[model samples]
Target: MQMSQLVLKTLREAPSEAKARSHQYLLRAGYIRRLSSGIYSYLPLGLRVLAKVSNIVREELDSCGSQEILLPALHPVEIWERSGRIKKMADVLMKVEAKSGDFVLGPTHEEAVIEAVYQDLSSYSDLPATVYQIQTKFRDEPRSRYGLMRTREFIMADAYSFDSDQEGMRSSYSKVYDAYNKIFAKMEIPFEPVEADSGAIGGDVNHEFMSPAEIGEDYYAKCSSCGYRANIEAATRGSKDADAQGVGSELPELLYHYTPEAPGVEKAVEAISDLGVPTKAHEMLKCLVAIDGDQRLVMLLVPGDREARVPSGMRLLEDPEFERYPYLHKGFIGPMNAKENSIYVVADLSVKERSHFATGGNKAGYHVTGAVLGRDFQVDEYRSLVVVRDGDPCPRCGSALTLIRSVEIGHTFQLGLYYSSILENARFTGPDGQQYPYYMGCYGIGVTRLIAVIAEHFLDDRGLIWPVSVSPYQVVVVPLGAARSKEIEEVAETIYSGLLKDNVEALIDDRKLSPGVSLADCDLIGVPYQVVVGSKSLKEGQVEIKVRRDGTTTKMPIEEVPTRIRELLGRSL
Candidate 1:
């Protein structure tokens, strides 16, 4: 490709909004242009990388006997409602008001694809089939930063599998699981599979393929001992039941002290301890009021030192929600017998064991010490919950688990009948000739996000360092002689043509630019190899070859440059 003819625009400085390394290089290299917040336009270079990524995904899925299919993006709300996700995903779903009816830009294809398949497919013979599509998906990301890493609209490869039984679904899932391992390996990025919560998608078991990166948005725990890995949302501590420091029939008076300055648990703990009570931060109970999906308030009690983690389908009470619960003291809320006030309580398992823990007195500027578990507050059920932190115990081996930051590139869910059973007319006949809901599995790979993740993982200070499998161009021809130099121009063209003849993607920098300028962009563009035809090297009857990944160069005879380039690229001329 000629640089002059191509719509390539390299920037001297990355846009101010492009903060991440991948985002900075991509913008500066003229690979992508910002369309709006969380949205972007892929230029020619970006499109080439996207194409290579899509091709890799298609080839891998095709290898697993997965058939390709495209589902409609403009979907009726009825399908989402039928799947029970209309409300659950309302926050991120992009809804549109059409002349015909309300529709949602499809974020996923669970309902649409299954609705189509169950209409036509039946019987055990058609039980196990995986259908996939590489297409654009939409999401209303609340905070879409980090360029392609978090986008409102992006490309994705989503696969849905149907099986007669759970066993068939497992088989299908395993194939894709192994295929994902192969996919990331082929892309040359370091990744780990972590157990994750299947939020909104409705699955009991799911694994997110996470690429370890410095600026990753997700945090996962990997056990150093037994190799237990899980996302923080689903990860658990290895410890046993919290000790209920046995309670007697008689209870002591709960000590409530006036603490006007102590608004938070930490401050309250210090104030209470100064008032002749021995206390520690961990000995204090922090009470929080959160509104559930039903718009009812639920009380949570974590240790004073721990931060609360809110999972999907639930959010912390906002100002409006707080206004509804006027009786509950703001900032000084506690678990009281608030059932009359429509506030239910659920405490962490650790809180159930602690005797004489400290908490808010449900009154402004007052905190209570010697607060008993059953005597002061109670929960309908004690859930095994603990705040996730670095070096937390591993659920598998009881060893310390370290939290690793990662980018979620792919996810696979064992979505057992969640969609097929919910959507209308979605059923299949089994070998017993009895109608049963379809056993389903869902898998997805973020095509655009993978590009960003790849750039983040493979690049260096100079610019993007694309892996050979996903580089926009395998080799770039840098003619060091000015465009007026016929000899340099001829040598560069010959090399570019030879590469094309060998079925290699090559970019020819034939523009009338200085060698230094062209070479700099060549490096920033991240072509895997650069064939430099310089007058200095040409005088020695040699052409210079520069390896992009590592700044290693070799001088080879001009006659052997094409074959040498092929050998260096691990391809044929």
Candidate 2:
């Protein structure tokens, strides 16, 4: 490619709205332009890089027996309803009303792909098959920010695999995991695979590929000694001792106290101190209501010093169990006198361990002080109900956990008949001809997000230092004084043509620009190898060669430029 014919524009300042370094550099380098809050339009340079990413994905998917197929972005609501996801995925699913009245933009193609496969392939002979696509996905994020990190619309490479049984699913899942490792390796981005919650997907076991970055939105905990890593929501904090048995039953009698204007735990603690209530003698039981539907409310009790932790596996909002009630008060909710079979009370292990505690009196302007847990009240369950914090001991190892912000680039899941059961995607070849639902595994890679992660991990103050595997061009030839002198132009053209003949991707800057301007642009683009044909070097029968990654520059004879560049790129590639 020639700079004279290219519409390349480099910015002096980064965009103000871009919060991430990758986003800022991408916009400033004239690679992409924002169309909306989370939408962007790729320019020529950006498209080249994106195409390279897609090609790598295609090659890896092809190696894993996955046939590339394009699915419809517009899907019927009925298919989603059949899979029981229409209501379960209400928030993130992008729905549209058309002439027929209802539709949805495909955020994922699990339902669509399974439905098609079941309709066409139903025998044991066709039991194991994988299909994938590299396409655009639409997700309706309520708060779309941080550039492309959490986008409302983005490109994703999703692949779904069908197997006859659990054993087959395991094999397929492992195959995809290996392929994903290769894909990330080929892209030259450092990533870590960690256990993750399936979220709305409803699966048994899932793993996420995360790239470490300071500005990432997701927080995951990792053990420094051991390699145990997990998202904070799914992480475990080993165990702690409970002081339930030490305190005597008759230590304090439960008493109701008149207290007003103390709504929160902190304020209540201050009020109790003002009233001269010994802090060590009494515990605090914070009552909260976890309402499912309008008809059911599960009261949750936790220690005042600790907060309630919701399990990631239990997606009550995504489950059909709580579809009827979407609006629930968060801050002002409390456990009053139990209504007629309308509420279920549950207590945390920490709360159950306390002897004397302070709680609501089930009325306005009143509270209970010196309330013993077993004596004053009895609840249903005492389980792990506290959110794990930083410095908490790891469950696998006793090492303290360190929280690191990271971006999710890929995920693999053991679906375990979740979708197959709903869609009736089954096959039979047994002696009794018994039909059983097929097992499934799902894998996804965010192709565009990988680009952003790479830029985030591998860039300097000047611009992106693209890895050799995914760089748009391997070598850039800049001819100084090419517009004024014919010798420099001839030398640069000869060298560029020779590089192309050697199967090396090269770009020539033949624009009517000063040597300093061209060299600055070359560094900004961060092409790995630079061949400079200037009047000074050309007069000495030599050309300047520089490596962008580490500022290594040397003079090479004009005849040796092509061979030297080939040797350099061959070693790096």
Judging by lDDT against the true structure, name the best candidate: 1
Summarize candidate 2's per-residue lDDT along 1-573 as a digit string, tens digits. 897777778887877888788888888777788898889888877888889899999999899888898888989999998988988889899889998778899999888887666755566677788889998999999987666677888899999888888899899989889999999988888788888878788788889998888878887889989999987667666644555543474578666665687666776666666777745322677766555435356777777777667654331233353345433223223344433335566766556456667776665556667665555565666655666668877777778889888888999999988887777554445335667777888889988887788888878877788887877789999998636588888899999999999988889998888777788788777678899888898888999999888888999899998788878877876
| Runs in model 1 lying further than 4 Å from the true structure | 240-244, 247-253, 258-267, 270-280, 288-300, 310-349, 362-366, 373-383, 571-573
TM per model? 0.90, 0.89
- For model 2 the local lDDT of residue 429 reads 51
Global local distance difference test of model 2: 0.77
Ten residues in sequence with the least summed lDDT for candidate 2: 325-334
Summarize candidate 1's per-residue lDDT along 1-573 as a digit string, tens digits. Answer: 888888998987898998898999999998999989989999999999999889889888999989998888889999888878888888999999989999999999888897777766777677688999987899999999899999999999999988888998999999999889988888898999999988878777799998888899888988878889888877776654456665675555688888889888778878887888867888888777777768777777777887776654567777666666667777677776566676777666666556667778788888887777767666654553565778766767778989998899999999987777666566887777888888889999999999999999878888998889999888988888455478888888888888899888888988888877888899899988998989888888888998888889999998797788778778511
Q: State the displacement of the C-alpha of residue 5, model 2, in Å, after optimal TM-score superposition.
A: 1.5
Give the lDDT of residue 250 in candidate 1: 59
Name the top TM-score candidate.
1
Q: List the residue pairs that clash in candidate 1.
A: none
Q: Give the number of colliding residue pairs in candidate 2.
A: 0
